[model samples]
Target chain A: TNVDASSSNCIFHWKNSSDWIKLNVGGQLFYTSRTTLTNSDPDSMLARMFSTSSNLHPGCIDSNGAFLIDRDPRYFSPLLNYLRSGSLILDPDINPKGVLEEAYFFNIQSCIPLLEPLTIPRDEAPLS
Target chain B: TNVDASSSNCIFHWKNSSDWIKLNVGGQLFYTSRTTLTNSDPDSMLARMFSTSSNLHPGCIDSNGAFLIDRDPRYFSPLLNYLRSGSLILDPDINPKGVLEEAYFFNIQSCIPLLEPLTIPRDEAPLS
Candidate 1:
């Protein structure tokens, strides 16, 4: 579909054609597409929040109207990235435990396997 | 981030955690993540329609409350796939022209470069 600026019926042709959503995760602000959230998991909390047929409304919103999620934002990027792509690319500096927690909160089951390998079992930890 | 089912403050812990969104495009049904649509392009129409901050409401809806879009559904899958991944994986049987037209209608500028190579200019057609 070539860009049709003159297509009267086309939504993209409208003057205000931006659907970018802002998320206030914890105290940080992040921008993303609704598709990314819904595609993460059909059973995930994020998916249901955006579902039009669902009776549940967003629990909170910031002054800017971004969805308010009271969770640590530090680990959200990887989760979002995982949703965009089917794989998780870990950040070496980030603690896998934290990300795993966030993934679980979001009910991103696919992310669990990817994070499992990075988690060191307590019994396996060397004396420290 | 761990899936804490008992966490009272966590939204994902709610019994109804699914946030999946349904979209009706050109009479066909498509399921996707909000992130995919917004991530495709901040300036695109799909992004704006899903943006909570935007004043424009969705134009149409099916009985199920799926946002209705008037356009050819045939080319939507590829566009959606491209949004999920940053690349367009074309189907051999699908016409690039139709996909290009749809891409233009959605204002998916990033898809244009990926599709341009597939479109054979009229001048390049061999005598037939």
Candidate 2:
């Protein structure tokens, strides 16, 4: 398929593949955050972030200090390197539980949609 | 049962009623927040609160701009006054979907337990 970035939806090439899959601009995120590796104190940064941070990361959320953001369950899949090691650039499953709790409270609709299929365990949904 | 506060649970009294059934300090919240609805501007306060507010209210959480905090499902119950009106002290179901979403992510164990019984629609439970 002759696809280009100009359109809201298009086809994109796959690595070492001859065919392209349909891509929707709105279906997925377009931007990514780059947390530069610095010699700064990791402990201090985590503490400061937990106390008060905008997004856990770029697309991450926090629910106090108890829950972290479980961005995508597919990320939890037992395939890629993230399954074995925590060395991925955009591993969304590395936050706290409070953060996820926060998500449940605020965006009930959106949260439900995103969480139900992610195959989250039944014990974690929390009381309404 | 000669219930007492000294116990892990106990019985309490009411200002109007003569007899007391039972009370569990942990079962229900023991404290509340005093916004001190003083001579403060509702607009600016809300702005400041939303942009960088921790806990939309007591026992409240935030997701993002798209969703607010929804504390409890029963809180959404129509009765007493919060149903026909909107003036309560501890309304739980008043947050955002994103907050709930966060809960689904990190604390899938706890989230599923609380959210499931709350009767959230299936469509809302994301593509987990």
Q: Which stretches of candidate 1 lie over 4 Å from their true place?
A: A1-19, A122-128, B1-128
lDDT of 1 by residue, B43-122 (tens): 77787777556554444344456665645455677898888788888766666766777678788887887787667767
lDDT of each: 0.66, 0.26
A9-110 in candidate 1: lDDT tens per residue?
233334221333557888775555456667668877777776555556767888987789989976876676566445564544578889999989988887
TM-score of 1: 0.43
Question: Candidate 2, which CAPRI tier?
Answer: incorrect
lDDT of 2 by residue, A41-82 (tens): 223322223323324442332332222333442232211111
Top-DockQ structure, candidate number: 1
Tens-digit per-residue lDDT, B9-125, candidate 2: 423232212111111111111111112111122332222232234233211111211111111112222211221233322335332232233333223232334444334656786
